[model samples]
Target: MATAPVAEAVSLDHRLGDVVVRLEFADDGPVRLVGLVSADAFDASRPPRPRVTPLVELSFAGESHVRHSHGTRHRNYAATSRLRLVERVADARRLSVTQRDPETGLVVVTTIESTTPTTVAIASHVTNEGAGPVAVEYLSSLVLGGFAEAVEADVFRRLRVHTCLMAWTAEYRWRDESLADVGLVDAGIPHPTSSTRTSYSFGALGSWSTGTHFPQGAVQDRESRQLWMWQLEHNGPWNAELDDVGRDVALSLSGPTFRQHHWSQQLLPGESFSSVRAVVAPVVGDVDDGIAALTGHRRAARAAGAVELPVIANDYMNCLMGDPSTEALLPIIERAAAVGARIFVVDAGWYADDAGWWSTVGEWRESRARFPNGLVEVTRRIRDLGMIPGLWLEPEVMGVDSSALGDLPDEAFFRRAGRPVAEQGRYHLDFRHPAVRSRLDAVVDRLVAEHGIGYFKLDYNVNIGEGTDVDASSLGAGLIGHERAYLAWLEAVRERHPGLLLENCASGGMRADPAQLGVTDLQSTSDQEDPVLNAMIACAAPSVIVPEQAAVWSYPQPHYSDDLNDFTMIQSVLTRVHLGGRLDLLSPAQLARVKAALSVHASLESFIPAAVPFWPLGLPGWQDEWLALGLRSGQRSVVAVFRRGGTATVLLPLEGRATILHPIDRGARVSEEPNGLAVTVPATPGAVVLDLIG
Candidate 1:
């Protein structure tokens, strides 16, 4: 394949709020998504000159296309090459590009809708109209190429790929690497026939959507000062790849694929399959602007749920550590009420009769031995203390030694090869089964009605490997069904209760993708007990979730020093504070300090939901001695600065009157510099939250 002769090609251009999407139909080839430029920056003269990435890249069984690296690259599949633009429909907020493959009678409709001024939601639907069934392996949800059109600088060197590295406790860690640094470099050949041999491909493989890497990231063009951020809105296996298409770069986002997640779907005649939804934002600014656009998209796309950010005190982090009993909770409850906690969540082990709760959960019954007066007694106490009662539940898994297994049918749990799928001594419940959903619904209703529970911390602890194969095409296909069904069940629960708050926690942020976050009211940022390390997670969490929805833990232990106590408080001040610790054991001075910090946090609640995040010192490293994160709402901003023992002077590129919002008596000095504000933290382990008023 070589460069085609220069000829004028027809394109269907549609302005989607903030960007102009141009679909090129050239020389009887596939309709390609060539231009996705910002409306303000769209260049009408430079229409795409070469074959860009197709809108829908599809691969089926036994179809071959010439000049396509079938095994190496996912672009230019045979099925996609035969797809021609059949019909297109557009409205004010959406554009639907429908392509037909006459050779196989496959219809691919790529629907793009403006989620916000700078973001769009995209998904592809494939339908088979042939007489025979087609085995489908790969299909892209969204494809955007031609980064070379953004700037004149070297695309490989100037384009920065921001990849999010996630782990159990250390989640939301961002790594910025250039294409050349990631091994995808320009070969210096003119109009190469195939894609680059190597690509910067990353994805999650199991049920934990963010088990290894976050499903969202940004590609920044440093020369043009433009950024394209995207999120694969799927709860199961998903993949995203950045590869070179000739001199330009392309991004392919999709759900589970046969090659990646052992997933394949057989589409019979008159049947259709839809890919996972992906939200993308292309902005003409830096990474912060890109994130702000995505935040706006998330805010616009999600339903109107609860907006109040209440202070929740859960007995899990440094206090109860899961073994919660009436004997151990009364003092903590009093202390929580004393510290202005609006919600009191009794975490795991509340249902256990003894210490053997690990392998005997899922009954959802209050343990008589743990709560002698029944769970209602504690709920009543919580209500009397002016706090809503909540409970932690791992609803998706039944323990191996639980009595509930005798009541559930084998089909109710995830099954493969005529057996239930067990992971870490727990059987994963298939929410696709009515029995499973019904049982969980009963549990929730009973707890809410009888115990007067107002909140539920939904925690998922185990990952049932690929998926169940019971009545399904493949493992990944079954997982997709269950994932969609689980989300539906969640929405149904919310509909029924309407006022109950649901906190999403999967072993702490493993399932923190937008698909889960969109429905849940709060997202547990991490289970990391060390507040010093949690600071890194808190600052970076805004890149993934909105500040008001991110529930970062602030557990100031009684044994901690004054500086350490303030450090822990600062970790969650900018975000939703999931307050936890042995507050009952804290001295008067420590309790006063904690109360003062929470007071400051309460005062800034109105500004957080509307604010966007900015890092004055850039995204923090794991061991970065000093860290600063700011949430800006127009001219007003609140900056949380932490000194983990580096240079005392912290410089911020903004000039405003900096008043100490928290720890007013701490020895932190602020001065107006010629270029910015210079803040001096006199102590090594000091922390401060500054309110900048211009």
Candidate 2:
């Protein structure tokens, strides 16, 4: 009898900075992650075993695999199939592995790139090579298993999951829970009648994918201090799940969910699909350390060359809400430029014929009624004042009464069941269509060339569920395709106009994912007008976005007191200050304070980009009485402390001599103690930024 052909196996290891990834591949077999460890861990001699786990878990065409006693079966093609190695490639920054299923003609290419020493970005590209189409119900960007030995000994009790809960007004609310709390921990053995395997799933759906839950999460081992954090870098539907499968635990992070989001992708022969990229890092420290690594990753992943983070003044928030005109904007523009704002943005209403311009937005032309002398005149005035002219444009949506609604073909807009998808009286544009991109390109080119527009605030307001099923097999696939096209258009526009600055805003901070944040120059933290309420968002935003790119609104109203004005100004100083509010309505004394704060911001701008953030008071709660966030460079550190209502004295665990830089209250005092620095504010709400020099 002839012996069976020997299985071909190969092992490869890649090192990115301090992170190491080792892969074991069997020709015409499973591809597994044999090793995933930090430099320190790899250096230490340890027993070697089969750390093999499936590289990706996928299901397609209703194929079933594992069955449970509860009468449920799950299909994971990657776990069951014998994938042949098609190609393997690597570079200084990235390692790519390609595998193909001979039976189904499905090809999967997984790539991991090191954005920083500790952070690695992961993505998967799937292609259909068969004669017929393939319907993919599930695809994962990153999946790692075989953590049983590391976590099971403590009954998986020491593993803690951390994620941020988000909403309209309140965003980035972090929630930390043990694996046992979420029912992911193994509880001894399963009874004969019941199954022990349980899955804990969480995700966000619709256009506002991160509206309810952020696509960022972390799993930390309290005993070992090993932290694994990931952020799904997509602006559309996304999901993440943690499954406890008795002997092993697995994680699946993907762009969309089939069960809840009505998402599916059909790929024809020669058609390929790419999943949303995810940034995963292994930190040996706490959450703060993880965030620092992510920050470095963000900086590394940004487009090459220096990016300017200037002070921007928008005539919105508290000043003008979609009612800008040449007469009303000239004084505000001059005042904003006088106050050290490098970019003056006439937010909203410049293209409106009437107050009901919200639904007539797609035209992108200067409103004859709003600018009788032409919008170019106002832009010229901005340039005359030595400020970059900026405009607010919602490029992704066509209003019901928009001129483009009737002019553009139906294929240019997102459609479901042969009808355009409309939400809140606006139709979402399908960036996958060349016509849609052409229209946006013309609009941007015209504005930049004719009106001298150097800045744009791209805003999205509505949440259109799932996506359109036009030329695509699945709604999620179509949505993701449009998103890719949109990013490509942005890249093209940037190439054409290298100096144009882009700001990403989705009804204020909703679509502030890494994908969008990576492309845009700045992100609006929130649309909150109340200075007191914005403190929480401002403090927590750096955890999700780079501090240098986080645009915190500093809009002091006309009726605000000196302390209130100081509070709002202090909030904006730590980040990219999007200065706004009725400076045209403030008294000279109050405006003087604003000017002083701007001066302080200008002084601090040089050091902001190099600083890494830390929360001395831990992550702030939604209604925390005292919030403290510190940024440290080399020998100097700047700390911002806000005391809302509860205490008079807050002790910060900072071990250095501190000098008050910009104190909101004259009575505020800073003293050095053996334990830490003690900051004292008034009984009422107050704010202070202290410069700690070592």
Candidate 3:
């Protein structure tokens, strides 16, 4: 008699805050993160899946997997399929699951921590305990299956993905596409299969974590109005993909892969490697709900010193343009203090003489030629004007002609094939090296102690292609190591100087990810100089970043009209304003207008930290005529609208008594309706912000 043994299946339903996760285990297979839902939608009595896959995908030596160029799953490996659950631990706020492969002695542990009621941060680590080494090609930080199980309809047609198109100067542009449109369709008709050949993926390729695309994505269920948003918290190359798994969809978020980033890791005995962190937020409503939950988590993750959200004035955007001299900065500092700016930052070109500063920037010495009495003269003046002094430092790069290059050894910089990796006349520093970190720490300490500097603008302008291949592993793996070391250095710096504020700028937000934003104080939204283009970026900034952390430029030129002044002023009134431009050259009327805008910003700054952003006109497009961003906290709401070149009138879905906050005499009118507000601007290129109380 022949008998078929029943499949061994087990499931654990864990709840953390308002979110629920279902962990599936099988005797013949690995444990899997099969389900994620809000507490309200979870049912404890539901049966578990008979078959399960690995929660952590590890592509190692002597293994083969079914994978496409864009996906990260469908691997048929005995190492993963035979893995057995070793331990499970949980609490009210966190959960940990551990599994091991007995044959190879490879262990994987996944930890999920609750950041908000609906947001959870997930990360994994792999340990090699075998006698021999294991070469890993691809490892996932987060892998979630059955993503579309809650939707009873056709998952492909009812699901939509929103991707952020990020680049230099053009950042945070969102594009929405259907799952079917991206080729993740149902291929099985009469006979169903779990394998699919297509996947929709987007990721960054180099040191610029947000260069080509932001490490952020969102999936929306059009039928049930469910939304799932996630961001991979890595400062270097990363990838995110969505593909079909049987009747459901799956998501894979990871730092680097052999296929994508040329990343591979050789793990020796008793060695462990940790993957990057990723946060997932589940909501039962639209995009706003997802953003609100993520925003709450981000605020809680910020450093203690960044709670104030102070106004900062930098002289690099459209005013001085990186040429900072004592004579040129004293007047600007006076005007900035007059306009109520809390911090004055001397941006770039402060460390070099008139000969040129790009190829000799690593020394970070105050140029006596630019400031005859040394930088102390300018910094002291900034302090005398009632503003905290700040300076820009690119700590991760060394100029080819830098004097420090001769003092530091070859191991201190990034190397490939026995030579230092150079890009744009600069050599990238390998933060993994202790010597590199020490040099940076000494530079920071010297500047802070000598110049009374309270703020540092950490700008990274160069992107070294693959990464360093100096010590061990592949180029991408080396990059991951350096990124982790860089974060550690940043944390150490913050600990040493508790009151210091660090602004993250990578040629203007090329490295603006949660990994950086979670540690830094503020992020520059863009380097876009055109006021019109900057307005569109300001409107969409809150979708990808928290409103308080998004530093939008409000640099108004002296020759601009009154309407144009309002337009530029409104660009940053709601976010952290990075004031620049020739304020010292403005006429009395223009200066008065600038002062009035700053007064409004000061009054509303308290609400900026706690407020969650929404768009009454939906997300703005690149060339959209009208753009709007709304921030709501408590019972009060603030809406900033701009008319680039469209009709003068646009209706917003809001209900309240509205009062103009800026440009009080402008021809803009706000008429309250039963459930909406009818807003009108008398002219194009006009902007306005109104306070609403219901």
Candidate 4:
């Protein structure tokens, strides 16, 4: 007996704490994202407003129609084609939607999991089901759009887009633009026109995942005070776009693609591939509210058995600059521990025996010339000082003159056209090869066992564009495979050395993507050495990374004045202070100030993990004279304000009753106002940390 499919419109709604997601289905037809609203804004009594946006969009080879063109003719079948729903399932924490395209033999299973009250993590898995290989051009992890209310005249005026631009020295530089200014909306009130269609897209090029821009953004509706924030959690080529689909705006988050980065994946029968996870959250307040929700989500997503966020002193930045030696680091180590650094890391040059050691790096052993008594003496000194021993290692690359370059198998290195892809006197390793993993494992194990090393600062310096075509269908696929293998190796390392702590750095803050961040313990915020310039990165980093995991360098030298020393120390106290610089060269008074700041950091360390960040002075401008950031936990809050070149008195919005408002240094004066705090600063640069007991 032939049975006809049910023709009724079916929908399912799931609530995760304060957020609601509703999915709609038409019999066995296409699936759509009908609703994604906060619990406070959603009205059950009103008729359902089903969004006309596809849940997932995919482009495959041999397809003719362009579903949603962004100034290009690309075959995007899943964009417009009817994706028949195979199954839908939901639980208290997650909702899964399974859909299949009959023409391409592609099955996409989208899962949305709630990590916090207001944040949902989304990921899509694509599998090839037919006999022949399917060439995938585009696969978006998240495709959300169709906000009709935003198209109204008044509402459209209040719409703004927020994205953070990043670089080597200046990271987390935020830029806010109106929807009309960004061409996402028309000039006049709501109207239909052929010229209204536009797309604003941005992404990174290679391994320096966040070199150009961060893979995170937010859209805010000022009238409703609602913000939608999202981040693509990948460490490689990634793209995010804001598209005008005629009636409404759309957002697509995906990795590399054929049209954009010459990336394509050929999936054979029964083969499957998964897109990088995209986390999206909706908050009912301002950007702070969105950041709070995302912070909670990040806390929930962190790996279990993570190390405590402690004060770490790395001998880099204003200090050694990859020239560490026994004589140079011993005094620094002694002073670092005296200032209460829980971890003392010997950053770079520990394995170098010559000036030309940069191109001869793959050997992880101690340098006989640099450390006469071997590295064990230094590690022992660090441990005896009541601190964990740490070292800097660039694990994924072999220097061009490295002996391992010839020792390791050719398949272990990334090769393009039978030649190793060399960049900046280094050859990238293809982690997909077992030889590469074995070599890294041996080096890590030897270091830990030989030196009793408890911490590792993993750094990646150069970008090997696209990737090498080895053991994969395309260059992008090869890169994806290597990334997955690297993640697996990291997991294995963590499993083996459960007590080891790893810090992620990329020339620094370049590879601070959620994909790599999910596995590592801390992130180096930036390599910017100047305290005044680093203030901008420190103030804005919490929006992209958890404050507890953001490692900001506080490097004070002898030449710095008392106010300058206080400014640098306060920059790191509010976050994971990666204390650096010539501690051995600092004067007694300057060292006292550094130790006092560490005391304050220790007092507040217990509350950092539970704290949610808020920008009292809004997102800091690149050239802003005054900047402020607050962290609220329970009824208490900690606010850090910096005065670079501002007026004498600057008013800061009060988060609560100022119970303990005091300057960490000597020149700054503080007073309470009716609705805010009036801070008076000297002409010289200074900073202060305020502890508000609500």
Provide TM-scores for the models. 0.97, 0.94, 0.96, 0.95
Best-fitting candidate, measured by TM-score?
A: 1
lDDT leader: 1
**RMSD value for candidate 2:** 3.5
User: Compared with the true structure, what per-residue lDDT tens digits does model 2 show for residues 1-694?
Assistant: 1112225776666787888787777765667766566665563344434543467666675764443412121224432455667776777778887877777788899888888889898888999987888788777788765444454446377778889988876888888898777776565554321235457778778888678888888888778788787899887888787765554556678887566567778888998878888888887888888888888888888945555567899988888887999889998988888778899998888888888987888999989898999998999999999999999999999898888787689888899998888899899999989888888999999999898999999999999888889887778778888887887888898899988999999988888888888778888888887888898888888888888899999987778777778888989788899998987888888888888887777788778888899899998899899998888899999988998988789889888878888754458889998889999977456788899988
Total clashes in model 3, counting residue pairs 3 or more apart in sequence or in different chains: 0
lDDT of 2: 0.80
Model 1 C-alpha lDDT per residue in residues 400-476, reported as the tens digit of each score: 99988988888888888888888899999899999999999999999999988999999998878789888788888
Off by over 4 Å in 4: 1-6, 27-29, 67-80, 150-155, 187-197, 303-307, 659-665
The C-alpha RMSD in Å for every predicted model, in order, reads 3.1, 3.5, 3.4, 2.8
The local distance difference test score of model 4 is 0.81
Which parts of model 3 are misplaced by more than 4 Å?
1-7, 45-53, 66-78, 189-193, 303-306
Worst 10 residues of 3 by lDDT: 66-75
Q: Which clashing pairs does model 2 show?
A: none
Question: C-alpha displacement of 258 in model 1, angstroms?
Answer: 0.6
